[model samples]
Target: MGVTLFHHVGGILVVFSLFQIFFTPHCDAGNILVYPLDGSHWINMKILLEELHTRGHNITIIRASSSWYIPEKSPLYTSITVEMGKDVKDFFDEFIQEQLKVQREGLSLIAFFKLTKKFMSFLHVGHTLWCDTAARIFENPKLLKSLMDSQYNLVLTDPGIGPGVVIAKYLKLPLVLNVRWITSGEGHFVLAPSPLSYIPVIPGPGLTDKMNFIQRIRNIFSYSIILFQQNFVLAPIYNAMCDKYIEGGCDIVSLLQDADIWLFRSDFVFEFPRPTMPNVVYIGGFQCKPAQPLPANLEEFVKSAGEHGVIIMTLGTLVNALPEEIVEEIAHVFAEMPQKVIWKHRGKRPSTLGNNTLIVDWMPQKDLLGHPQIKVFVAHGGTNGVQEAICYGVPVLGIPLFFDQYDNLLRLQERGAAKIIQLHEVSGHTFQRGIKDVLHNDSYRHNMQRLSHLHKDQPVPPMDQATFWVEYVMRHKGAPHLRTEAYRMPWYSYYCLDVLFFLMTVVTMLLFSVFAIFRCLFCKKTKTKCKQN
Candidate 1:
């Protein structure tokens, strides 16, 4: 009786300790100003905001007047609406449609160039609108005064858009970028050492880190496209904005590289091994959580699958549905499969609809991924979805449409955790075969499970790491120590090309001097021989 009582007391103590460790919030309650990029980026930003709110931080969001996802009133953050930005959401919808049209033309050099032009053209329009919006905010005196008076501890923002970065600079606040992408390219290219020999640029012609000579050359060529997009397409607009509003003026790339911390949305688990910076906190799957109990009807539907389990397919938020013909192929494929299919489809109901398939307008993606019954995830290869798939140990069948989707899936495919079927390759035969290959292949499940284990094995949970770093910036003002001074150097100085030139000059002079001495000696000896003769 005494031993049993002692064990019970110990159990209670352990339970209390666990509760304290997980549930307790840090004491600092900071005033944070957030300028978020809307659409899918807004989804992850909201997750980070919720965590900050839970920890007693007061959040203020700078949203455009035309933002669709971010509401004016929310318990999590007080919204500051900036007027005159376009209702920018529909632009992406159009861009993706055009990209799909181009992709369907299939693989050729001309087609590739055509698609790239379309992408660059799309970026030009997006950046032009953002520039106009930033100009409006800069022109507003009252808005500037209000932001200054609020006295934020730091500016936490999505650097996918430039206004937040400019705003942070204007306020002289310590900046923390919740970034996977900056205005120019992937965050790492600016933040860390990226050797093109190894680290393949995402969305470039190269897909994996291991590149041959030809692939490396292709990588360099593709990298130039990003540089062109940044310097020519985006720079003039941002530079003009900076000159007008900012005191002395600053360039967009400099302002971004000057950020105190980068909460990068990738880790080695999801990405190939590459060089990184101290301040880059990788909270790759931070938004993922343990699965909640399914709603009763959904639970019943899932249970009805018995031993076959289930397959969940979503092409992410941007795409409403695939092209009608492709959708019919996928729908017919699902009909033939033995497993239950819960597809997030809102397009015209396919005539090939199966009793085994459940079509919904939306889904709790994270929860469904986490569920033990989930067999394989058919995805559009978006960053959020890919990371979630990694977190949940679900193998993926990727149907890449456009943007970074193919390259994103390539990372998983290289690891043997996923398979990719191009937009043009989708057919009843291909879709069915790909699903079966991923579903039946034990290696796919085992490899994905390995990644899941590795991702979860971090000492601090990704979300906690993200929240800690945000508060750390507030406490320390800014982490200048972690930031490298390499960004301050000019390109020649940065790569030590100037130093190389100086060394080469010195070596050449020494060699010439030595040759002159030898020549003089030889001439004197010849003179002596002539005199002797």
Candidate 2:
């Protein structure tokens, strides 16, 4: 009886200790400054920031007013608008129009090479415009002085902008990076243990972990191009900005190398095999929550559909320049389907609007996906949208546009959870068939359900995991021990190229020396034989 009682008591103590470690809230709160990347990135991060605010941390977010407008005084957190000078934003607006025009042309079976060139041009223009905007922000003497005076305990930023690094350096704070997409920048490659061998780099042309020799070659080529664009084309502009703004002449590369933590908006199920270090955290689909009840009209519409269910189509915030012809084609297909469709169209209504389809400028996508009546999601394969679909166990019919969207959709198709219809090949019949295939095929549903289960089966919710790590970093003063030593290694040393080259040289010299000795011996022996003869 005594022994049993002792074991039981020990078990209880162990349980309590585990509970305390996992469930205990942090007593020490911090003042954190967050740098926002655009509207979509902000949407991805909003929930976690709110959770941190509720946990007693004072959060100051610097974002564009056009994307997220918070009142001057809010009880939850603070919002500081980063003013995008009038002409800059307008110029980007025009650039977006030109990009859309190119995409529209691409849909008419334009050559893939032409489309790629246009997309690259668009990316270059965007980076240049963004750099200019960032410079403007850093040049504001008042904003810079105020930010420096804020005395923040930590700084969190998206790697999409170089200004964040400059700001952090100027403020003399430990930096944490959050990437809102699967496609990574140079910082990720430099700071994390993510290598390109198995990890398909962003702008990947549909390469996967199960690549053959040819595919690996293609991946290497694509990775090289991406690196060139980031380091040569983009990094110089950022380095210039950093030098002009920061007092100590900060190197953007060094700043990223020393970053405290990396929060990735990705998960293992959606990504290929890759190495990751401790400081890296995957928080994919963290923004998804239990669905709120639908609005009255939407609820009624969904209910009216009955057994046919409904389909949801959204192309994300940045993809607003959809062509009219494609819209009409989609509408014609919707007209024939039994399912009612909710299309999130930001532009003028399609002339072919069917009775079975409803068009709205915006909708609560996650909530709709959670609804039992929502059967299929027609999306452009953006990371957030695809993750949400996977989270809700709703199969996707992906119409990928550009950048990582194609790669993301390819992964989904590989997993048997989705079907991808290239925009250039999309017609009424193709779009309808794609939707029907995902909907009627039992495999898609089963695969997506399995994915959802795997996603939810985590030790802690993603939000809590993010919150714990954020506060842990705060309590421990930046968690430097978690960072990998690879971050500090030189490029050549990091990949061991120098070591490999030295080995090759030694082996070559040894082979040459052996060959020379053998040849000399053969010649001397032949000479002796000739003399004897």
Q: Where does candidate 1 stray beyond 4 Å?
A: 1-27, 531-533
Clash number for candidate 2:
0
lDDT tens per residue, model 2, 158-186: 77765676677777788787774322243
* TM-score for each of the candidates: 0.95, 0.86
Q: Which stretches of candidate 2 lie over 4 Å from their true place?
A: 1-27, 64-75, 86-125, 136-142, 180-188, 193-197, 500-533
TM-score of 1: 0.95
Which run of 10 residues does model 1 get worst, by summed lDDT? 82-91
Question: Tens digit of lDDT per residue, candidate 1, span 1-533?
Answer: 99999999999999999999888754479999998998889999999999999989999998778887889999999988777556666778887887888777776888788777877777778877877887777778998898899999999989888988998999999999999988877889987899999988877773688788899999999899899988998888789889988999999999999999999999999888888989899999999988888888888998999899999999988888788998988899999889999999989999998999999998889888988899999998999999999999999999988777888999999989999998887888988899999999899999999999999999999999999999989989999999999999999999999999999999999999999999999999999999999
Clashing pairs in 1: none
- In terms of lDDT, model 2 sits at 0.77
lDDT of each: 0.89, 0.77
